[model samples]
Target: MLPGLFRNASRMYDCTSRVLQHYEALYRLVGIPEKEMMHSIMKNSKFELFLMKVVQQKVVTGLIPLLNHISKSNIEVDLQEVFKRFTFDNSCLMVLGFDPISLSVEFPKRTYEKAFDEIEEAILYRHIVPKWCWKLQRWLQIGQEKKLRKAWDAFDRFLNQRIASKREQLLSREKTHLEEAKFDLLTAYMMQEEIVNMGVCSKSNKILRDTAFNLIAAGSDTMGAGLARFFWLIATHPSVEMKILKEIKENLMVKDDKKEVGVFRTAVKADTLPSGHHISANTPIIISLYAMGRMEEIWGEDCIQYKPERWISEQGGLISVPSYKFTAFGGGPRSCLGKAMAFIQMKIVATSIIWNFHFEMVEGHPVSPSVSVVLHMKHGLKVRITKRSV
Candidate 1:
């Protein structure tokens, strides 16, 4: 029903032209041929510093005040909403060089933000209902189909406006100092287009719009939901929370620290299964990462338990599990491009919040996964916040 970024012909599923487009626009941001350019961009000192500054600014100006208000009012706050706003603001700033300030203390309602949630929910509806049923709704423009249409339009307008603005700025601005300035992803795309004279696919504004939308969509909501789940798990397991806190305290004192899927696949050629099951060519397969993670064979008897130590080595360092085994950020060639960026953002936000506040889940509040494309909390995570004295 909805085919903006995730389902578009030029999206991740296409293994040919779309993949090349992604490599040119996203992986080779600066017109460089480095295989790891995207990861390098995230790790660059300047980029890391820029991220730190943005996170600190948001926490000081946005999050702290909101938490203070919630504490003073003694009311339960839906942490899911808060994280969504926070990550949305950050993603906008990082991707488009614009700050919507959606994460303010006032907690204002934003139509554009609401559009994202609507789009995700509608996509999930499309999966559950019969394809013909949704097709009929799309034909008639009724129900969830109607909402998806509006949401798609909203995304188009918002992204088109930003792309136009960035193009104009690049045209009017002098080229001498462009190399010295830090460029957002949109800026980088425009610059790369100028240098490489990208192919017809990347030359069009549609590609840019789709790329921007995909990055922002992937960055904001997924990160927000993941953080909410992390906090929820920590709050429910006191030992884990305390260990995190203790690690933070010790690291601060030492002054040194380091720190999905409606997924499917289609077979191109005839192949034999490793488990002795054979399939013909052009077979479509659905892989469930959730089920894989819970399998006793893969994760042992305690796979269902929430144990952070599973990822820790005997030497106290992180154990590297193959991407195919973990499969959260995806595996193999089409793995997530934003993995490094996501980790940096999560660490900055998680550490700041964990150190500065203590979260207690509201008693008797229900917590379960939402029935959507994104793994959002169904009823939202309701919690009481208290300021922590460091």
Candidate 2:
């Protein structure tokens, strides 16, 4: 049975037959086949220009102000929360053509943000409980299922409001000739609908809503959690951190340096595996990327250790690993479309933070992985920040 969170819609996580066809149509407008579309988008001048502008604005207006406040206060801060806010703002701006300004020195609480967390927790709950149990709860409108329903409503309201505002803005821009140079994901999708006559605009709204929800959901927390783990790892491994700093300084003349743990997919048809295992159609498969990353066969004896050198060659270039072996971002046709965008954002944030501040973990603070859809810190990454002399 499908989880309440997804329902019957063909979202990014859904494996319905129409999902591929929809993605293919969208991919065509961007001038690339489905398989190669993401890579091409990363290289597209318009997209790159848009991303750069958004990142720069966020760094200056959101990240720097907050970091400065934390540094001046000299109090321990949860780096995870900070990262989450930063990514959330960026995701909204890139996907919806608007910024909620969630990342700030004030650390304001956002209803939609909390709703996303609740939705995710409920999704995980559905996975652990028996299918019938969750379905019963869903039908009765109680427990995690109730919370999921509420969160879903809040999420839908948030998106619908934004979509309406965007439509109005587009119409105004057409008459006024005040159009932006870059189109956000939502704007692009809406334009595609109009140009291609995919369906009635009203019916297409649900598809647009789902697409926006999926992109923001996929981009925000995953990047936030990954960066949180990255910083914690670097903080604990001083030697690796120093090496990164050295590389950043020597190579860039200033500055500094820098998943979903599993991939879940449903088999579309009955197939026999290369490893001789057989599964029926619609069998769900979960590839443990966390386990894969730690395997000695995949990453050598030092696989368990956090070593920056593992990814570097003797010639000081990045070592190339096939996507199948290094499956952090998944492998094959359904690999993450945001992989390149994620790296670019990570580099910008990491370099800025490392170059400007030094982080120290709070004494006696415990750092461990949380049990959730995304591998976040059980206890958030608490640390104090000091401004760097440079």
Candidate 3:
């Protein structure tokens, strides 16, 4: 309940880390399903309002420009195409505050982006069944066992390298030893110069790597898919789009003087081969995803039906929606620490396309939920995007 920036950030950080720790044991712990923590955090907590502000600001600020540009470029992207990268970008930023440039239209090789994909696929394989089952398979050199073993080893290699690299970077830069002792979680964790008495912490690094990867895997894809669904609903529902656009034109639009929304290409890093923008705490984006769903009045009969009018107030003003009813970032003791961070990438990708493009299902694009750690479109969200006239 602390007010202003940094108000509850420290507390939030503590809880986030705890949740991360709990996730390390998720596979071993039963009855606790994958992604259950995220749902429990959002649906069953008090920080709902705080979560929404973070997500909404991210959309309105960080993501909008990039989306707008993409839509304007005569490019084509299906639902699956968008969500895959959309969620990937959001997840990476949330986990490491480092943005992969692949999401950008100008991205070159896709190294960092592919690395994330590899990590995600590996996480999914471990969770569907039990760890012993995987080991059992490895003992026999079974079908996927080889691939799984290789993937597991590769994943560890990547994390250890990253942890070591970050440590070296910190040592070189902070030589003065006079700078603030404050360091983000990753740096602090990597700087454990003292070796532990047991391998408990060392073995646990694999889980840390997996859990960090899961943050992107679970948080990014699910939210990205949800955003895509929201956009599909809004775009297909003209009345809904009108109301949202109206609110933007009235409440958020600027005249010739106010700086137009900055194109977010700079928000994501542009160089570095497989490039991504560096997302920082300084310009965090708020997702406001739940509000997109909770405005019953604007949507009417079934605001739940993807109607946009629900976003407009009864008096035609841009209305406020309660975070608890609409919260996607979640609330209470363990809301997503990267909630605002996720919002920036998600909103930009979603809003830009919603405002300018209409997607049509490909001849026989199947739409079913792939039940796993995150909600994936069973057959991928395939569609054709047609630009809306200016």
Best by lDDT: 2
Q: What lDDT would each prediction earn against the true structure?
A: 0.69, 0.70, 0.46
Worst lDDT window (10 residues) for model 2? 1-10
What are the per-residue Cα lDDT tens digits for candidate 2 across 105-218? Answer: 788888888898888888878777999999999999999999999998998999999888777665565644214624577776555455455542443556567778777877
Clashing pairs in 2: none
TM-score of 1: 0.83
Better of 1 and 2 by TM-score: 2
How high a TM-score does candidate 2 get?
0.85
Best of the two (1, 2) by lDDT: 2
Candidate 1 displacement at residue 179 in angstroms: 8.7
Q: Count backbone overlaps in model 1.
A: 0
Q: Which stretches of candidate 2 lie over 4 Å from their true place?
A: 1-43, 174-178, 198-203, 254-261, 269-278
lDDT per residue as tens, model 1, 257-303: 32100455667898987777788898866566657767899889997
Please give, for residues 112-186, the per-residue lDDT of candidate 3 as tens digits: 555544544544555456779877777986756666556556655655665555445655756443132213224
Compute the lDDT for candidate 2.
0.70
